[model samples]
Target chain A: MANKIFLVIQREYLARVKKRSFLLATLITPLIFPTILGLFLWVGMSDTVGENRKVIEVVDENNSFFLESNELYSFSYSELGQEDAKLLVQEGLRFGFLYIPKLDIQNPKGIVFYSEETPPISMITNLEASLQSKMESLRLQASGIDPLLLSAFKTNVDIQSIIVSEAGGERISNSVVNYAIGFLAGILIYTFIFVYGNQVMQGVIEEKSSRIIEILVSSLKPFQLMMGKIIGIGAVGLTQFLIWILLIGLVSSLVMGYFGMKMPQQQMLEMSAQQGLFPADGNPEIVEILQMIQGLDFVQITLTFLIYFVGGYLLYGAFFAAIGAAVDSPSDAQQFMFPVTIPLLVAYMGLFIFVLDDPNSNVSFWLSIIPFTSPVAMMGRVSFGVPWHHLALSISLLVAGFLSTAWLAGKIYRIGILVHGSKVNYKVLWKWLKQN
Target chain B: MEILSIRSLNKSYGSHVALKDFDLSVSKGKIFGLLGPNGAGKTTLIRIVNQIIDKDSGEIYINGQALKMDHVRNIGYLPEERGLYKGMKVKEQLLYFAQIKGLRKQDAKQKITNWLEKLNLSQWKDKKIQDLSKGMAQKVQFIATVIHRPDLLILDEPFSGFDPVNAEIIKNEILELRNQGVTIVLSTHRMESVELLCDEIAMINRSKKILDGTIQTIKEEAKTNVFRVKMIPDSMEYVPMGEELRRQDGMLEFKLELKDQKPNELLGMLMSKGEILGFEEIVPSIEEIFIQKINESHGE
Candidate 1:
C-alpha cells in the first residue's frame, strides 16, 4: 500500500510541478510580495522630493531655541515683517506663517505651526519633539539644577532572564524563541488548512460536475479515488512549497548581498540608530539578539519548529482533504469550512492572548499540550523555555493528531466522493463518518 | 464461453427503479449491441457491470467466476461521459490511466506510443487534452480505455460526436477488436451500427430486457409476413381482399389477410387474371423494428 501510494505521490508531484501555473506561481509569488513592498516604500519616499513649501517664522524675543531637523520639510530663519509674511501666505508664495507672541516665562506654549494644508504629521512631530527637549533643559536651568545632573537621573533597568532545567543547563531569554516557534506553528497550520482544504473541494467539484465520478466509482471504490486525489494534490502542494522555499532563500541571499554592497556603512548605522537599535555599540538589544541566536537553546527551538510545522500541516491537511470529499461545491464547502477551520483560528487566538501573554502560564501549558493547537502553542512555549517533558508530550500529541485525522478523513472521503446533486449537511456527514 | 454475465440485477435511484430483474450475457468474441432509448436503464446496467456503481441485488460473473478486484483489470470500459482530465497532455493522460489499469511505466509508455502512432495522434502527443478537438480527445480517451488490453470491452455511446468518417473509423476499430477475440458490449441509439456490427443483441427498456436474440433470429421472428406483388393490375379489386397497404414504384404491397386466406388461391386468381411480373417480401429495418416494439409495448 505504501509503495502504491508513493507511486501516486510521485506522479502527482511530477505532473503538477511541470504545469505552467505551478511554475509561474512558484517563481512569481515571492517576487510579487517584495515588489509590492518596495513599490509602496518608493511612493512614500518620492513625495518628499521637490515638494517643500510650508514655513513658519518664529519671533522669539526670549531667544528660545525651537524647530530643529529638516527631515520632512526644510526650515529657514527669516527676519521679516509680520504683514509681509501674511501677504506671502495670502499670495501662496509661502504655504503658511506662524509667530510666537510671547512665552509666559513660567508656563509656556513654546511653539506653534501654521499651514494651509495641515502640516504633514512627520514635520509637526519633529518640531514638537525638538522644542520639548529644549524646554526641559531650560526648565532645569531655571530651577537652579545642573543640566548634566538632571540627565544623570536616568536609571538603567536591564533584566537578564535565566532558566535552569534538570536535563539541560542554564538558559537565558527563551521567550523570543518560544514566541517565534508559536508564530511559525500558527503560520504552517493556517497555510495547510487554507491550501489543501480548497484542493479537496475543487477536486470533488471537478469530478462531480464532470460526471467522471460516475464511471470512476464503478471500477475502483469512491474512497480509493478520494484518497488518490488527496494524496496526489498534497504531493503537488508539497513540491511547490519546497520549490518556493528554495527559490525564496536564493532570492533573499542575492538581494541581501546586492543591497548590502549598495548601501553605505554610515547610512546603515544611522538607519539602525533611528530605529533605536544598533549593532557593535550603543544599543544592547542588538547584541542580546545576536547572542540569543547563537545560544544552545536556539537549536531546540529550531528543531521544535521544524517538527511541529510538518506535523501541524499534515494534521490539518487531512481535515481539508476530508472536507473536500464531503462537499459538492466550493461554496457549499464553506458551510462546513467554518467549523473545520475554527480550531486553527482558535489556536491563533489562544497564542495571541494566552500563550504569548504568559508562555509559562497554566493556559499556555494546557493549550500547548492539546493536540489540535499544540503545534503552534508548544512552539510558542518553547521560545519561553519550556520543560523537556512538555516538549515530548507536545510532539506526541501532534503525531497522534495526524494519525487520527487521517483515519477520520479517509472514512469520510470514501463515501463523500461518490455523493453528488444534494447539499451535504452535518447530518449526512455524521452518517458518512460513522459508516463502516 | 461467455465472457460476462449479469443476472437478476436490481438498482434504484431512491424510489424510482432504474433496473429490476435485469439479466444479460455476452459471449466471447461477439460484438453485442444493447439498444434502448434515453432513460431506458441501459446506462444503469452498464454502470453496474463495470462496478462503477453498486447494484442493490445482483451477481455479476466474469469468465465463469465471481467478480472481484482483478476482474476490473480484465475489463475495459469506455463510459458515456468523457473521462479524460483536460489539464493533462494526451500522452500523459493516457499513460496515467494506463498505469492505474496496472501497466508498468515502461509498458505504458510503449503502449501509449503505439496507440498514439496508430491513431494519428503522434504529433499531438504532448498537447493538452483541452487543446485537442472533441474528436481527437475522444480518440485519446479510446486509446486510454483499450491500452491495457482487457478481454471484455464495454463502450457506451461510443460513436457520439464523431463525423461519418470518424464514426466509420471507430466502427472498424470496434470490429477489429472483436475480430481479435475480445468480447464487446456496446450500448447505442444508432441502429444502423447495430445492424452492421452486432451478431447478437439484447435491448432493455423500463428496467427489463424487452428483446434478446441473434440479429437474424429476432428480425425473422418480428416479421409481419407482408409481401409485395406486381402483376397486370388484375389485383386492383383483390388488393382490398388481401388488405392492400399501398402501391409504390408500380408494385402493389399488402399484408396477408390471415383470416381465411389461402396463398395458392390468391396465386391462382392472380395467374388467371394477369401474368405475374414480380413478387417479393419486405423486411423491417432495425429502426422500424425498434419503433414498432416500443410503441406496441407501451400500448399494451
Candidate 2:
C-alpha cells in the first residue's frame, strides 16, 4: 500500500512537472514579480533621471549684496532687459531671472521676476523670505536699530516617542516592526491558502473528471490518495513559492547592486510610512510596528505560522479534493467550491478587521486557534505579540481541527469518487457521509 | 475448482435496479462469456466482482473461498471505461497499475517489459497515453489489466477498438491466459466472438438473468425444431414432418419441423425424393439465440 501510494505521488509529481503548462506556469511565475516591480520602478523614475529643475538668475545690478550661494539653484546676473529676460526664460535660457529693480531707499517694492513654469512653492517662498531678510537687515543697519533682540528669540528642539506597558514600564517605541510583522504575516497566510487550496481542487478535478481517479483509488486507499495528493501538490506549491522568493531576491539584489539603488533601506523606511495606510491615528504606529517586528516571540510565531499554514492548507485542501471528486466537471466543482471557500474567505476578512482593530483581541485569538481560520488569525496575532502559551494552544487546536476535518473529508471523498450520472446536492452529500 | 462464483447477486442504483438475482460461475480454465445488450447490468456485475462497487446482497466466492478485500488482488479487471491516466507515459502507467495489483517493483518492471514486448508496445512504452491512438491505448489498457497475471480476468468489452487483426491477437492472448488456468469473464455485445470463444455464458437483460449455461446447452435450449433439406428435383411434396417448403435456383429447399419427429424422417423424405443433394439439421447460433431470447422476453 505504501509503495502504491508512493507511486501515485511520484506519478502526480512527474505528470504535473512534465506538462508544458506547469513548466510555463512555474518558470514564468517568478519573472512576473520582478518584471512588475521593475516596470513600476521604470515608470516612476522615467521622468526624473539626469534632469535638474532648479535654475535661478540673480540680478545684482549694483553689487549691493552678493547673492548667497546655493547648490540646487545657480545664480547668474540679468544681462538683458526684463522683456529679454522673460523671453530667455521662455526659451529655456534659464529657470527664471530675478531683478533687484531700483528700489526706494526704504520701501523696496520694485523687484522683477520672470519664468515659464512656476517655481516650486517652497523655493519661491524661501527666496522671497531671504531677499526680504537681507533687505530688512540692510535697512536696519542703515537706520541703526539693534538686531540683538531677534537673535535671542530663536531655539530648536527634537522630540522622541516613548510607550508605557501595562505595568507602567516605559520602553522605546518599535511601531514600524509591529506593523511590518502584521502585514507580512497576513500576506503569507493569504497566499498559502489561495495557492495550495486551488491546486488541490484542480488536481482532484483533473483526476476525477478524466476518470483516472477510480484507477488511482483502487490501489491506494481513498484517504491515502487524498493525503498523498495534498502533500504532493503542497510540495510542488512550496517549491514554486520558494523558487519565486529566491528569484525575486536574486533579481532585486542584482538590480539594486547594478543601479546603485538603496531599495532595501528605502523599503524599511516605507514600511514605517505604511502605518498611515493602516489608518491608526495618534497611536505611535511606527513604534508599534517596530516593536512587533523586534519584540515578537520569534520561535513561537514561526512554529505557529508553520503549523497554521500547513493545517489550514490541509483543512481546506480536503474539502477541495472532496469537491473535485464529487463533481463530474470543473464547472460543477465551482458551484460546490464557493460554499467551502467562503468560510476561509470570511475568516480572512474577519482577520483583516480584527488585525486593524485589535490584533490580539479574543476574536482574533480564538479564530486563529481554529484550524480553518488559524492561518490568517494566528499570523495576525504574531504581528501583535501573541504569548507563547496562547500560540501553542492555537497550534494544538488547529491540529485537532485539521485531523477531524480530514476524517470528514475522506468520508466524502470515498463516496464521491464512485458516484456518477447524477448531480450531488448538499443533502445527498450529507446522506452519503452518514451512510458511507 | 471454479475460480469465481457470483451466486444470486443483487444490486441497485437508488431505486432503479441495475442487477437482480444475477448468478455467474466460471470454471478454472474456461473463458466465460457474459453476453448482454446495452443497459444489461453487465458492468454492474463486473464492478461488484472486482469490488470496485458493492453488491447489495450476494456472495462472491473466489478459488472456493468467500470473496474478501484481498481477493481483489487475484482478479484482474478491465472496465469498459478507459482508466489510464492520459498524462502518464505508457510504461509508467503500466508499472503503476502493476504495483496496485500487488507486484513488487522489480517484478512489476520485468513483467511490464515482458508484456510490452509481447504486445509489440516496446517502442511506445515511453510515450504518454494521450499521444497514442485509441487502439494503441486499448492495448496498453489490456496490458495494465493483466500485467500481474491474475487468476481471474474480468474484461468488459476488451476488444472494443481493435480491428480484426488486433482483435485476433488479443483473443489469442486471452486464450493463452486461459490455457494457463486463468478463468476469464468476458463481457461484450459481440455474439460472434462469444460463439467463437466462450465455453459457458450467463446473459442478463432488464436486470435479470435471461439465460445461463454452457454455449452448446443454451444454443440447444434456444433451438427450434427445424431442419433444412436440400435436394435436386423430383422430391415428394408430402412429408411426415411438419411442412415449410419452397424451391429456388434449380433445387428443392424445405424446412421440416420435427416436433416429436426424428431428424432421420426428413432424411427419409429427401432420400425417397430425387437423389438427395444435401440434408442436415440446423443448430441455432448464439447470436440468433440472443436475439430470439431478448425478443421473446420483450415480446418484440
Candidate 3:
C-alpha cells in the first residue's frame, strides 16, 4: 500500500510539476508579489514619502493659539484681517485660512477654516487638539495657577510593555507587532488552505471526469489514492513556497545591498533599543518598531505556523477531495462547498473581531481551540502569546479533526468516485458514508 | 486451480441489491466471460473482486488465498468506464500504471517500450493521450491495463470504444496473453467476442446468473431439438411433417421438432415426402441465448 501510494504521489507530482502554468506561477510570483507590495506601500505611506505640506495662513485675533507645524501642514500666523486671509486662500496664495476670532474663551465660538479643498478630518482633529490644550491652560491660569509651572508639569506619560518569561528572561513587546504577525500568518494559512485544498478537489474531479478514477481505485485503495494526492499536491505547494522564499530572499538582499541598506546592523540597533542602551532617536517610532520586531519569538511562531499550515491543509483538503468525488463536475461542487467555506470565513472574520482585538478573549480562545477554526484563529493568537496548554489542546484537536475527516472522506471517495450521478445530493452522500 | 473465486458474495446500495449471493470461480489460464444486460450487477461483482468496494457478506479468493489489498497487484482491471490521463504522455502514463501495479521501474520501462512497439505506437509514445485518436487512445488504455503482466486480467467492455480492426487487434492480444497462461475475466455485451473467446461463461440477468457453462454445454442446453431442412417438393400439395418456414426456387425450408422420433425415423419420413437438400439440428448462438435469458428473467 505504501509503495502504491508512493507511485501515485510520484505521478501526481510529476504531472503537475511539468505543467506550463506551474512553471509560470513559480517563477513570476516572487517578482510580481514584491512589486505589488511596493506599489501598495508607496501608495499607503504618501506622507513619509515626501509630498508637499500645505501652508495655512492663520489670523489669530488674540494671538492666544499657537498651533504646531507637522508633515501635513504648516501654520503661518499673519497680522491680517480674516477677510484678507480668506482672500489670500481664495487667490491660491495659501492652502487654507484659519480665523481665530476674539471670543469668550469659555464658549469659544465662530472658529472656522477656509480652504479650496475640504480638509481631512485628521487635519481638523489635529487643529482642534492643539487649540483645546491651549484653552485648558488659559482656563487654569484664570484659576490663578502660574502658567510657567503649569507648562513645566505637563509631561506625557508612556508605559513600556515587557513580556517576562517564567525563567526570568525579559523582552520588550508591542501589541502592534503581535497584530502584524498574527495578521500575516493568518492570511498566509487562509490562502494556502484555499489554494491547495481546491487543487486537491480539482485533481479528484479531473480523475473522475476523465474516467480514470475507477482504473486508479482498481489498482490501489481509494484511501491511498486520496492520501497520495493530498500529499502530492501539498508537496507542490511547499515546493513553490520554498522557491518563492529563496528567490524573494535573494532578490531582496541584492536590492537592499544595491541600495546600501544595512540589515544586521539595523537588527543590532533594534536589540540595543530594546535594552535601552541608547537614548531615544529623532523619531521614537523608529526605535520602537525595531525593538518590537527584535523581541518577537519567531522560532515558536515558525514551528507553530508550520504545524497549523500542514494540519489546516490536510484537514480541509480531505473535504475538498470528497466534494470532488461526490460531484460530476466543478459546478456540482458548489452545493457541497458551503459546509467547508463557512468555518474558514468565520475563522477569518474572528481573527480580526476577536483574536486580533484581544487574543485572550473567550471567543478567541474557543475559536483557536476548535478544530475547524483553530488553523486560522490560532495563528492570530499565537503571535500574541498563547498558553502552552491551550496551544497543545488546539493542535491535538486539529490532528484528530484531520484523522476523522480523512476517514469520512475516504468512505465518500471510495463510493462516490465510481458512481457518477447527475443528482448527487447530501442524502446520497450521507448514504455513501453510512454504508460502511 | 482457480485463479479467482467469489463465493456467496452479496452487496447492496441502500435498498437496492446490486449482487446477491453471487458465486463464481475462474480457472487459471482460461477466459471467463461475464455476460449480463445493463444494470445486472456485473460491475458490482467485478468491483467487489477488485476490492474497490466491499462485499456486504461473503469472500473472494485469488490463487487459493483470501483476497486482500495486496491481491490488487496481481489483478489488472480495465473498467467499462475507463480512460487515461489526457495530459500525460503515453509512455509515462503506461509506466505509472505499471509501477502502481507493482512493476519495478526498469521492468516497466522495458515492457512499455515493447508494448508501444507491438501496438505500432512507438512513435506516438512521447505524445499526450489527448493528441491520440480514439482508437489509439483505447490501445494505450489496453497497454496500461496489462503493462504489469498481471496474473489475472479483468476486462470490462474492453473493446467498446475500438473500431472493428482495432477490436480484432485487442482480441488477438488478449488471446496471446491467455496463451501465456494469464487467467482473464472478460465482461462485455459483445456476444460474438464471447462466442469466439470465452472458454466458460456466466450469463447474469437482474443480478442473478441465469446460465453458466462452457460454449458447447450452453449451446446444448439451449437447443430446441428442432431440425431445419431445405428440400425440393415432389408435389406442390405434398407437405412435410413440420411447418414450412420459407420457399424459394421450388425449394421449401421447414422446421421439424424431434419429438419422440429418432433421427433416422425423422429422415425416413422426410425422405418419403421429398428430396432433402439440407438437414441439420438448429443450435442457438450466444446472442440468441443472451436475449432469451434476459427476457426470461424479465418475465420472472
Which regions of candidate 2 deviate over 4 angstroms?
A18-28, A34-175, A259-294, A418-431, B233-241, B259-262, B295-300
With a 3 Å backbone cut-off (N, CA, C), the pairs that clash in candidate 1 are A174-A383, A177-A383, A178-A383, A182-A380, A217-B52, A218-B51, A218-B52
Give candidate 1 regions above 4 Å deviation: A1-7, A32-154, A166-168, A174-181, A192-220, A258-283, A296-354, A360-382, A385-436, B223-241, B247-251, B257-300
lDDT of each: 0.73, 0.75, 0.88
Q: Please provide, for model 1 over A1-436, each residue's C-alpha lDDT reduced to its tens digit, 9 standing for 90 to 100.
A: 3434555555556666777888788789777755665566566557666465345555554667656535455455576766766676677766666665567646776445555677667766766677667778888898898989877997889896666778577655645654665676566656765776576567667766665565556456655665566667766766666777777666655554544532223444565568755455545664565445444465786688667766776677677777777776677777777766787787778988998879888998998888788876776677777778888888898889888988888787766766667678888888777665
Q: Which stretch of 10 consecutive residues in model 3 chain B shows the poorest summed lDDT?
A: B235-244
Residue-wise C-alpha lDDT for candidate 2, range A1-436, written one tens digit per residue: 5765676677667666667887787778777877787778776676454256456777665467556656557677756667777777788978887888767648777676777887778877877888878777678777886666655765765354464556676544344555666667667767777777777877887777666766655455778788888877776766776777787777877766665675544544665687744344534554354443444457766666666767778777788888877887777876787766777777778776876467667787777676677777677667455666777787777778778878888888877887776889889888877864
Error (Å) of candidate 1 at residue B167 is 1.2
Please tell me how candidate 3 rates in CAPRI terms: high
Q: Candidate 1's chain A scores what TM-score?
A: 0.76
Alpha-carbon runs more than 4 Å astray in model 3: A40-51, A57-63, A76-102, A113-118, A254-285, A288-291, B268-274
- Distance (Å) between predicted and true CA of A5, model 2? 2.3
Pairs that collide, model 3: none
Q: Largest TM-score belongs to which candidate?
A: 3
Interface Cα RMSD in Å, per prediction? 2.5, 2.3, 0.7
